[model samples]
Target: MRKILVLSVSAGAGHVRAAQALVAAATGLHDVEVVHCDVLDFVPAAFRKLYAELYLDLVGRHPHLWAYLYDKADRAPREAWFSRMRRAVERLNTRALHEEVARQGADAIVCTHFLPAELLARRIAHGEAVPPVWVQVTDYDVHRLWVQPGMRGYLVAGDETAFRLRELLPDTPRIAVTGIPVLPPFAQRHDRAACAAELGIDPQRTTVLVMTGGAGIGSGAAMVERLLAIDGDFQIVALAGRNEALLAAYHRLAAAQPQRLWPLGFTTTVERVMACADIAVTKPGGLSISECLAVGLPMVLIAPIPGQEERNASHLLEQGAALLALDATALEYRIRRLLADPALRAGLRQRCLAIRRPAAARQALDQVLDADAAR
Candidate 1:
């Protein structure tokens, strides 16, 4: 059996999710033993906790500033600074990872997030002799920083993103457009009405799935309160991902509005929810947007982060597939507007269908195979 190492970070849910999907897809193929590792999990507990808290705080309290930092980080020339930082953490992670790699004798290394890809590439550059490192771009817009010089493969979300990366870094020969690497669950067909009935939702009323990203970054409490205040009768499902406090708070707030409000905490069935939803109210995280498209859920985009998400929102809007809303008030109004006009909804739905890429994961797996075959 060939071994494959899937490296990911817990900075946000999307990166971890993308890695999980790739592992799932890769495992079904013969003779592959997939090992999953959380990059931060290897670090000191205090530093790990501090990193997670700081990441959430920065993105939640200052999205624009975080976006600016991402852009700035991408623009800065690759230096020994991050390489040295990785080396510092290497003392914590290197022994365990090296043992696992040597024990499994890994044939390939897959990275869904830049942190691990960066670290692995630096290790290889330092003559660590690790296996082939494949960097999978998890977002719609490709960042220049993801293009590590000696990477064995680069799997991007789409041809446009792949082309863009090629333009930015002309020397990376392993680049391939493999879509976004969504799992088969999102690709599978479910009986939408049946799924709705199972979830205790009214099939007649339009179901809107509202998400606050992985850590519940936004004021979901305020958003749900404002939505309830609108006096609408539509079925609303609010997903507070891994936010037990937010979920409990919503449960209390929803006490008076059980018929229209449905709150869920961390769940593995988001693809099913998206499949059953008529529309989705969400931040424009590329993974979420791509999953929505896969499930044919038109999006009412709200509170996207400033740089790449802003670009993603604009792309959806320009494609006539999503309705953009600035905040809670706008979100409520846009939801009503989208639900009210059948013609508009149909138009947007068709556009979403046009953009849906169901074969992304399989295609990405093929690219991994091709790269391996080439070697």
Candidate 2:
């Protein structure tokens, strides 16, 4: 069996989710062994903790600063001194990563996050016989950090992103517009009436699913309150992922309105809940949006973090699959409009169906396996 290593980081759930999706796809193929590696495990515990926490802090508390830094890095030249320094530090810190790769005897390296790709690219540049690297960009937009020259192929979310990659890395090879990889469950077709019955949701009422990714970082309670206040015959399914306090709060809110509200904590049944939903109100994280698209659920995107999330929101809006809710007022207005107008909701759902790539994970797996076959 050919061993394939998928590298990911936990700065956010999207990267790791993408990696897992690829693993699921690859596992179903013949003569392949897939390994999932959390790249942070190779580094010191302190560095790993800091890396994850720092991202949360910046995105949650200091988003504008994060946006500024993201833009500055994007504008910096690939070979600039800062870029070189950043790559050098990553290469040094990921010595264990290289060792792990050799020990696993990986035939190819697939990276969902950019850090591993950068480290591997540097090793390849220095004449190391590193395995071919395939980068699966987990966001709808590509940051400069993801642009490395030695990559075997680049997998992106859509044609617009492919166009952006061509403009940014004119000489890069084999950019595939594979859409973002989502889990098999999300990719499967689901019956609305059956799913609603399974979840104990009302089939006649419009169901709106609200989420804030796995971390439960967004305004779930506020959004739920706004949605409930609207005068409509709709039900709210609020998922507070891993946020116990938020879950408890939602439970309290559901107590008063049990018929119309359902509160959920961290759940493995997200795909099922999504299947029962008429629409989703969520942050514009790549994985969340991809899963929503897979279900052909129209979206009401909440305030995305100013960098990658902003880019993701823009892409979805441009595709006519989602409407943006910039604030509490906007969220209420958008929800009311969708609830009031079945034609508009149907239009958005059709657009989502048109753009959905349920087989993205399988397609990405083919890209990896085909590269090995060519060699």
Candidate 3:
């Protein structure tokens, strides 16, 4: 059996989720041994905490500032002074990752996040004979941070993203325009009425699923309130991902309007919940977007975190798969519009299905294994 190491960083849940999806596909092959890990798991506690949580802190507390920082970081050349310093610091904190890579001795390595890819690429450049590494871009956009040396291949969300990757890493051996890999469940079908009944919701009513991001990062309570204000026979499912406080807030809202507001906490089975809804109102995180697309669910994106997410919104909009809601007024207007127009809803759904590649995980795994076999 050929062993495949799937690595990610927990800077955001998307990267780790993408890695898990790949592992899910790889596990079906009896001849492949898949090892999944978060690079942060092997680092010192403080560094891990800072590396993992800092992005959330910045995006949540100061999004505009985060956008500025995101653009600033993207502008720096990989070989520049600060870029070298950041890489040096990452190396210092992840001494054990080098050891871990040496120990794995796998036929192939896959990284859904850029951090480990950076380290692994450096090792290959230094003549460490690291296994062939493939880096998958988790978003529709590719930031400069994802440009790493010595990678064997690049997997990206679309042809546009693949073009971006090519511009950044011109000498890469291969670039595959694979959609972001999502869990198998997203690609599977579910009974809408049965799912709604299971969630204690009225199956006949129009349903709107509002995704408070996996990390509880979205336009939060205010957005929920705006959706509620729309005059329609509709209900909302609010997903408050690991945020206990948000869950509490959701529960309180449900208490006052139990029939209309349904609160959902963090869950591994989001696909089932998604089946219960007619449309999704989300922040347009890459994984969330991919899941919606896979399910052929229409989307109304609200308050995308600037940079990659902003680009993701633009991509969906250009593809005619989703609508962008900037604030409470736009949010209310869009939901109301979707509810009123079946033709519009059908059009959006068709567009979503048109862009979805539900078998991305399996396809990506097959390609990697085929390449490994060739070598």
Candidate 4:
């Protein structure tokens, strides 16, 4: 059996979720032992906590600053001072990671986030006999942080992203345009009426599913309030992931509204909820967008994080699968408009259908394993 180590970080839920999806896919293949590790776990506990807290603060409280930093980094060269500093900091955790990989005898290393990719690339550069390294880009845009010359394989969200990556790494080989891997549930078909009945939602009413990614870090409560104010015969299902306060608030709101509002905490049944909904109001994280598209759900994107999420929003808008709402008023307007017009909803659904790749995880797994075989 071949041991495969999948490295991810929990700075945001997307990277970890992507790693989980890949693990699920890999488990079904023969002769593969998948080991999952969070790179942050190797760092000091204080640093890990601070890293997560800082990410949340930047995205939730100071998005504009995050955007500025993102743009600055994007424009900077790979060997820039900031890049070097970031890599130097990352090196602190490398010894622990190297020990873990050596202990597992990992024959292949897959990275869903850039930090591990960089560390592994550095290992290969230093003449270490590191196994084949496969880096999966977890966002619609490829930042300079993810580019490394010696990576064995690159898995991207789509051809447009692939084109951009090729431009960034002209001589890099094995770039595959695989969509971001989502859980198998997202790919499977669900009965809308059955799901609605199961969730106790009115089958006849138009359903709007709202998500703000796994951290639940956006203006979810405010968005829900705006959505409720919109004049339409619709039901709202708000998923507040890991945000206990937000979940409690929504639960209280749901109590007052009864059947009209359905509040959920972090759930494994998001696919079922998506099946029951006609539209989704969400933040455009790559995994969320990919799952929504897999289910052919049109989207009203609100307040995506400055860098990758912004790029994801642009791509979905360009594909005609989603509409961006800059504020509460715009979100209300977009929701109302889509609910009132079946033609518009159908058009957006068709666009989503055009781009959906339900088997992305499986596809990515096959390619990664095949690359290992060839090596």
Better of 1 and 2 by TM-score: 2
lDDT of 4 at 36: 86
Judged by whole-model lDDT over C-alpha atoms, candidate 2 comes out at 0.87
Instruction: State the lDDT of candidate 3 residue by residue for 1-375, as single tens digits.
Output: 899899999887899889999988875588898888889989999999888788888887788899998998899777788889988999999998878877988898999998999998888889988899998889998998888888888888999988877777767578888789998889999998888887899888888998864222334776687677777788999998888888888888789876899998888889988888889988889999999999999999878898999999999999999998887677788889999998999999999999998889888888898888988
What TM-score, to 2 decimals, does candidate 2 have?
Answer: 0.96
Runs of candidate 3 exceeding 4 Å displacement? 213-219
C-alpha TM-score for every candidate = 0.90, 0.96, 0.96, 0.95
Pairs clashing within candidate 3: none
RMSD of each: 2.6, 1.9, 1.8, 1.9
For 88-175, candidate 1 gives per-residue lDDT tens digits of 7655644555565566567888888886777676678789878898888888787766777678878887677878877777466678
What are the runs in model 2 whose C-alpha is more than 4 Å off? 213-218
Whichever of 1 and 3 has more lDDT, that candidate is 3
Weakest ten-residue segment in model 1 by summed lDDT: 212-221
357: Cα error in model 4, Å: 1.0
Candidate 1 TM-score, C-alpha based: 0.90
Error of 4 at 77 (Å): 2.2
Report how far off residue 77 is in candidate 3 (Å): 1.6
lDDT of 4: 0.85
lDDT of 1: 0.77
Q: For residues 1-375, could you state the per-residue lDDT of candidate 4 as single tens digits?
A: 887889999998899999898888876668887778998888888778877889889887788898998899889987899888888877874678788878778888889998888888888889988888888998887888788868888999989888888898867779998899998889899988999888888888999998863223335676687678777678998888788988988888888788789988887888998999999988899888998999999999887788999899999999999999877777778888898999999999999999998888888887887888887
- As a whole number from 0 to 100, the lDDT of residue 206 in candidate 4 is 90
Candidate 3 positional error at 118, Å: 0.6
Question: Worst 10-residue stretch by lDDT in candidate 3?
Answer: 212-221
